[model samples]
Target: MTTRARATVTVSWPEANTRRLARQHLAAPAPSASASASPAEAVGAMLGAHAQVLSAAELSVGLRGDGLTRTDVRAALWAEGTGESGRTTLVKTFGPRGTVHLLPVADLSLWTGALSAVPTGPNLFSKDARMTPDQVEAVVAAVGDALQGVELTVDELSDEVVARTGPWAGDLVMPAFQTMWPRWRQVLHLAGHRGALAYAPNRGRKATYTNPGCTPMPGPAALAALVERYLYAYGPATPAHFARWLAAPKRWAAEQFASSAASGAIEEVEFADEGSAWVVAGDTDFPDEPARGVRLLPYFDAFTIASHPRERLFPGTAYERALGGGQAGNYPVLLVDGTVAGVWHQRRSGRRIAVTVEPLKPLPAPRLRDLEEQVERVAAIMEGTAELTVGTVTVGPHA
Candidate 1:
């Protein structure tokens, strides 16, 4: 097979088992020819940098029972204990542009500080944007008043700005300030940073803000530790990934990369197909064997979104559909021999699970059988029966 054909592997495994593996991979000190550690800790350690954010996404694909929307995905994470004690905490900010993501409790402070200190460049939040420091301060004050100690959504906060400052306050709102609602959130996501917001469960079984109070951002040392964690979890990675993840300038990420390299926190390896990605200090043992069967990955899973130059995991042709038109397309896919072969679904009639297979390319008979057997295993786990149809899977209401 061409290298592209062999880049990534998608397989079916229990969500709990996968998380256990992630923990195991992340915790081991370094890769060894014959190290004896449980797969659970290693997997956790692997995801520890992003705080197991990637693993949670993968979990959604396996257990959420399909037909997930964007909001549905987030809700799933929350249910799985988004930032809860035992689970990876999705720190409101850590990656590029204050996007909310899971971060390990251990590394929070370091990443938070590094990101906060980094200057926002030509981006809207940059020093010279429409909103000055005073304006931001005023807005913050108004937001506090409007919340009246209540939590609010981004929309609600924006509305308060309009009401207090006048209709034109809405109109005259600086582009940067306006952009900050979403964009600047990235700025705040630095390792030690925290928002003064309070979250509550909404009707849709997801988190909603009830209070707008801000949380204190972490101190310098704490932020540094967070950055170190990122290197540990996803190192050997290039500055670009770090830059995008933290919204930090490429230079800052580069500097961090050098520091991490010097400390032996991360290592780099170019793959036959996928190119180089940062692996943790001892993650050299990332499974090279073919992942057993088709894995239904949830949208936005970390492995899918892990880094740039993703040649290691996805082929050029697959992207047309996998990420159709640049929107992260969410398709149920088939993992054949450790690479994505096609998309699939499951149907239910009474007690049986009917699986539909739509292959991007043809498969050999033996491979097809392997896929069927794997499907049966999934069915057995879900329904206590191995009787399954693999030709065309879809989901129907429970009988």
Candidate 2:
């Protein structure tokens, strides 16, 4: 048999940054409103947006879309108006890294199927916690049945789960996020990732859960699809990056990458810092010039979370300022020429918003002007006025 060698391409840091900015819709302001006419279309381009903070997720989409408002994002999430008037095209669920995300409703099958395939290991529960496989399945089924045609808070659903299953389900508690989480409730997060459940509009200030109304794709096929989508949006990237992003085991992630490479679904590339990476096959084109502008990205924005080679994205003192303690999404980021330059936060009073930026280094006049324009856009999204302040400020976990 004849042997064929896979092709490899080299990309400089500047070129890679330009490609990422363009693909993520941060290269320049979108040319027309039609480019991102709807929330679903905007989110689909980036695969999915980080949504641990609902307001940040809304701003992520709003910033990408031309003339999109917070109201538009809310309408897509809740299906607010009459028939064909307010469409519920997006759903909130547990996604990559077991974190909350806003995914296109149409792609739930793929997301659920791929995420469910990740091997969580033998001891999924704590040593003291008692939860068998059958009991877990029962809890999952009870959650689905309880959520049918109705939305229930986590506490309410826990009650229903205990009723249908047993008190043992309620007794299994484990520590999480500085509090004890009932083991039965853990399945609820899995259920969302499995496409059996989704978040509904809150009642007053309480969060609610409901059925997502989609069938999950089979496990193996879904992983393959997810691999392709990840490469398209975040490559050229290493298997380790993909594994870390998904919170999946390194071996499984490597297997998926190898499988994709063998099939010519993705091709190897020479990345500036990573040495070797992979990008979607035949996707080698990049802009002639690097992206230039200032952007105020909200906490957990897709652009901040998805990019790899952290040093390149967060150069010099930016690493500590934007991602202190090695954690992403802790604070809003200031982007100068497609790189993290500082951290920021906003305070709202009636119809006005005051934005405080803490830059790692001094910014020139042009960059400062560009940042002012971004503040105006943020204020417009909130339907209020804005005031900008360039000075030191404490934000994020350590603060």
Candidate 3:
């Protein structure tokens, strides 16, 4: 006998975007001085900000939290702990997709513990440059220990790591930006995901590494909770979408979603065209009004990267014009009414900024005014004042 399928709620793309934007603080900006939220908490609301280009990450967070400045974002990440346990409120480290992200220090346990579950990939380094599993283990241990009580520059960390492990750990064989990095550095993501190392504040021109000095919750529980959080933040999504976002294997992600659904932690729903997807068990409500606003998003913003159903999010010519060959976050976006309305670029000098926007369609006076205000806010996020220009943005991605 065949078992009956569970009832699934259907949601329109407009409704879905509305619900997601609300959850993400993109539907309406929260007053920064509401006495209810801090920058760290803002970062937490978005899960984490993609920080590969740290300045862009700052804009992503600052814009979501009205009145917040880039300085506020940095201070939240770099502030010293005043309480008995001296963990900074925010940490910059490897997060989802194995990319650098700014995560709240308090949630490091969840992120590290969850990320540790992502399966390791085969090494692509030259045979001689590769370290054996045993050697990798030794290097990871040494890197963690060397970082416990102090921060170390890559060069200094290299020396200690080599002394603690062996010369093999120091071999500059792993190729990087036209150069080779030490073999042991290959495990940097692994180290961060395991709660071993985190980024300390930059020292002069060099960045330093330090022990996170936090414990990761155990893997199984953390991984489950992570899936729940993702569903809450970006759900009505298939396991395939989740896999792509997490950089996890598709089969493994399928199992995770299945387990969550089986456990009643998430429920399946029918979302536009993607067939069935998952959302948090009780989070099916959506707003009647569409998400309406004018917002400027920075490169590699979390919203652009993680939201799904590409056709719906991209809409019209955005699929060809604004997107970088269909990938989100390569070019900064101009979002209006919860969809990609255009692309924008910013150039800053000293205390001034010039922002240019290219719209897919003509912006009415009201939207244009909103765009100017959005540009002003973005400049404030950069700690500058901006002049807005409505025309072609000739610069290429990340320019």
lDDT of each: 0.44, 0.82, 0.85
Mark the regions of model 3 whose C-alpha exceeds 4 Å error after superposition: 1-4, 29-36, 80-87
Q: Candidate 2: give the clashing pairs.
A: none
Best by lDDT: 3
Rank all candidate structures by their lDDT, best first, as comma-separated numbers. Answer: 3, 2, 1
lDDT (Cα, tens digit) per residue for candidate 3, span 1-399: 967486569978888888878777777544445533466876787789999889988888887676778877777787634443454577999998889999988899999989988887667777888788898788878989999989999899999999999888888888899998988888888888988898889999899999987788998889889889888888788899888888788999999988887888998888889878888998898789888879888898888888998878889899887788778888889999999999999888888898889999999999998888888788877899898889998988777
Q: For residues 160-236, write the lDDT of model 2, one tens digit per residue.
A: 98999988888748778888877687676788877778899999999999987778899988988888888777788
Assess every candidate by TM-score. Answer: 0.57, 0.94, 0.95
- Of the pair 1 and 2, which is ahead by lDDT? 2
Candidate 2 vs candidate 3: the TM-score winner is 3
Ranking by TM-score: 3, 2, 1
Worst 10 residues of 1 by lDDT: 9-18
Question: Which regions of candidate 2 deviate over 4 angstroms?
Answer: 1-7, 82-86, 121-125, 176-180
Root-mean-square deviation per candidate: 10.0, 2.2, 2.0
